[model samples]
Target chain A: MKRSSISSFSNPAVIAELAAHLHRNNVASIHIEAADGELKLVAPVGASLQTTHRATPVLISASQPGSLLAKAPTAGIFAAAHPLRPEREISTGSAVAKGDIVAFVKVGPVLVPVIAEKAGKVVSVTSETGTLVGYGTSLFTAKT
Target chain B: MIHVLGCGPLNTIQDLGRAGYRNIGVTATGAMDPIALKVGNLLVGNDEDAAGIEIQTFPFRIEFEQAQVFALTGADCAARLDGQDLPPWWCIRAEPGQVLELSTPMKSARAYLCLQGGIDVPLVMGSRSTSLRGSFGGHEGRPLAVGDILPVMAGTTISPPVNGFGIVPPAQAMPNLFPVSDTGDLILRAIPAGEHDLFGDDSERFWSQTWKITSQSDRTGYRLSGAPLQLSAPVELRSYGIIPGIVQVPPGGEPIIQMSDANTAGGYPKMAGVIDGDLWRLGQARIGSKISFRQSSLTEALAVERAIDAYIDDIRRTLPLVANALVAMTKR
Candidate 1:
């Protein structure tokens, strides 16, 4: 099977596969952007497809008022917790302080922490564990 | 510099090890878990062969005399920096006067602490590793003690994230490569040695039965207890060169796997030699743990080595990128 990239989202087959993966993994949403365009897919609770749109790429999005996102600093795999640690660093409704590591982006053998820019309560963890994430991909949505 | 506040005997400084002098009867004494030491060194931007502290006995406590960047790898010792819990396989900067404590690990054996500049122990026989038997290398050629002050080599300073970062431990990252028995015994891959066929049926038994690591085990070798392995016929043999991981069965019919501090030569009947790539896992195996052997080929052994090399290469290539990205992000 061919690997999917941001550019491949224009293909219907790739989009369908990605949506199926999102539903299978129970992911809340995925927002991807490249120089050419952007693709946003939101799978609501128990729903396969709630919203799918193509819009101007916004590097950082404040989906909810006063809610900040912890974005991926580089492109890599998303890990909710350090692979060696049994406990997740942050989850929905968890309180986090500024500079707290809410998640990690694993670029091959290296693990880069996704730090919370501001102290807030995590409203949602947008990225699925073990999924590929791009630079500026929202990992956690937190409200001050 | 760092001051050893509390420590147990046998914790010493080690690099990759002193090589080539084994023929002259000098044992190659190095960190039991060499992979951990290498990874720890790399994490702190040191050469892979840079010297570091190998802590097997704990609780080890030290006070950093100056602000230093360090990395801790290997066994999850539940380390704490000034009362803050640090993750295993992690690297961070320790402020001057900050205390770092490491408790006994719940699982696995040995933990490594590598500083940005590496340990400044005088190299004897071309390595910083302590030759406990020879008593000439490392921090005065003996294990560290309380009040011992060790110097650090000067190196270029590189900033890590405030809280530091960690890599996925090799055991967790490459679980499928090494096999574990159904009963939770470690399965080590080995190649048949010079006298393997001499044991006849016992050689097969050696591969089949699970052996328990006896308490007599040390850095020199592991004395395994299992069903006594006997040879088809008794034969006299001349002493021959030996290396780490050589499984030899003495007249007592028990197997002893030579380790990092292995003797230069031995006269015992050889059964098999564990692959070098899996020696790190054996190094981490605790006394009383069970282990089994799986016959492997040279091809398979090289494959395992390549896999390990790939892991290290990945870390070397990505660490700087991640660090640079984090620095850029924080500056924004």
Candidate 2:
């Protein structure tokens, strides 16, 4: 995970190669030093002509809202209504009181009902039935 | 020592990678899945990135020519050793006559097999890596086929110590995992490069809307197609050097992800590049998978770089020093 640095070079060939990677990754500043004092090949910002510039950054921002969902903290299959009966409205964001049956999921073979946390508008649903969803997949979201 | 079964297409010997040879157009061709290699190596007390077998899409079955400790990583292949199931990411000292079989993987696309001493192949151009494009390094620049028996270098100071089996720790020491698959949203953060301003705003926005990886994906590059971006005018640029993350957009307006073994120079217009740490995840992507792009600031990208460095430091701290010291000596 070290900041992999490429040896600085003034050769047009080497400069172009390094630039393309740095530019695509958006590496704004490139450190350049040469023993011969014969350094060149510098380009203006947004110089889209050279292969030497590439952007390389990833920024995580709070602007983009991410939802955290609660699950059984275990395993089970999912259902909208009670087992051995007809299914009903299971749309995400459906309102339900505390302790109301929100969905049922089967772990291995046994079916278990998942209770609602607090009353809220559903934001997003995570999985489909028997989809082999992992421990992290977001199940139907409830927006408070 | 062992008898290689099938080296799979494009399979060959590899080490940590070939480095410091960009002056001569030589690439640091190493394992596509470094996390797996690190784990397998750790299981057997071998230094990370030691030479091993890289099986892309496997049913790899190797007959043990000698008793040795071995481990598997990368893909969730149904590893059956002598007709018995074997646990993944754990080291096992096998009997001399044991034959290990790994069925085609179900979870991942590539599989890495790390042995106590590692697969010994001749070092060429300062590495044991195979660069087929140059047709030189590694087992004659080819995959080991049936009846190909690689003789392990005699008198290696074995690390896992013959009976060194114990509770293997987690493959990575930290939780900064480079995700293998994009959960339905195959998006990558990139900065505009050589051709950032060529396309009109509408066309550029359309690119992020719907683009799919064409079936023509390969080790050399990944071609994506959907709609063409309108350019201000057709400008011709001279050929220039290239890198793995470079994205080249042709006159037809198709974008391609240049990968390892990519040409050192190219003529087409370059677009954007996948982040370095994220590029490794590309190794596990299935063909025809959807890929999306997001623009990020250079400042943010550099921050991502720092976090990665910190994560690596955590893993390196727990590494057994025996192999690292020995490997360092040979590298010097």
Candidate 3:
């Protein structure tokens, strides 16, 4: 396949710039392709295609649970449960608050904690600390 | 029996792959490209998810202890059995002591080799896929090795190869296996998520404008390099549910997009997600490529779903014919 580069943002500093540009340009069809292992977005037409889009969440089980959730907003080292140093134990049905420091990450000098939401039995502790993580990646499971 | 002569960096038994285990913390560890697996199986009259061999980027040799019909697919490797060329996506009868070979990846990472009758490997969680990180399923949950004796069941009774080779995956249905872009940066269309306002306009601009992918990408997520992932509401928000391709920004300013094996929950501020269709691209991204993100409306994003469904519908159309042929063969 032919190789190419695509830059969606003009400023390349914040996504808002792209969002603003998208709103202004009204991007219709965004063509994101990978050339040479890189992903590029190529959509000359802006915003007009909204008419062809769909609306709905790919929900499973229930619409959602009423219980609060604890999560990692970004990627980093997960500290609680993991393959090597997994979180083997947690208090059963304990009421934990959000940002309760249930786990910690060592990204540079920042040691962020994997927190807890209003807790129940620690349903599960997913990955381990120092394991490469991603944004919106989870670390704990508290069934409320 | 199909015997392994020499395994490369990684090679393992894979079937349709493990599913429904994400909620229980297990990845759907299976062949990276399901379509290729199907092509190989179709040629050999094996179940698409049947136990077979997955060849990694590197190449190796395997010896069949008995003559068996088999096919290889994915990566377009130059395969040879006893110095004779082997056709991809086509079934062939190999004689015992024949040294089957896979030379190199033509345009992809993994490839599949399926015997006429599927190999009857024990299943784990209803699959025979290998989990590299966890190292627990599919042929001992690890790559293959030399001198390993693999069991192969009798080829299922099926129509002649004439009817099989007549089938071809539409060109569009073929996976990109290896992406053709070098921009390392992953462009994902996303919906504004929690903390959308917290980062305010200025930071969002940075997210959209200046960023490249870090060398730190894998099956989990891609890390962005640029201004610190700052938020307008800098206050820490409680964590919540996260999905593959979900873009989350931390205090450092880099936005990471989750992948197929991403965790189910998180604590960082989510700005948006890499659109679902583009997600598979995440699987092929090489490290240190440039990356960018765009906001997509719910309606626009669903367009991706519809597009994908059309592709699936095409595959579904062919299955009935194959299944019918199998039924007739069994009756005979």
Query: Compared with the true structure, what per-residue lDDT tens digits does model 3 show for residues A78-106?
Result: 44531212333343344555434455432
lDDT of 1 by residue, B184-205 (tens): 8889999999999999988999
User: Over the full model, what C-alpha lDDT does candidate 1 score relative to the true structure?
Assistant: 0.83
Q: For residues B84-202, could you state the per-residue lDDT of candidate 2 as single tens digits?
A: 64444445567898898888765446777788776688888677777868887777787767778876653233443222222122222222333222456455667778777876583
Interface RMSD values, listed in order for every candidate: 10.4, 22.0, 24.7
User: Which lDDT values do the candidates have, in the order given?
Assistant: 0.83, 0.58, 0.56
After superposition, the stretches of candidate 2 with alpha carbons farther than 4 Å from their true spots are A1-144, B154-183, B319-332
Docking quality band of candidate 2, CAPRI definitions: incorrect
Candidate 1's TM-score: 0.86
Q: TM-score, each model?
A: 0.86, 0.60, 0.54
Going through the candidates in order, state the TM-score of chain A alone for each one. 0.57, 0.44, 0.43
Best by TM-score: 1
**Accuracy of chain B in candidate 1 (TM-score):** 0.98
Candidates arranged by TM-score, highest first: 1, 2, 3
Residue pairs of candidate 1 with colliding backbone atoms: none
> How many clashes does each candidate structure show, in the order listed?
0, 31, 68
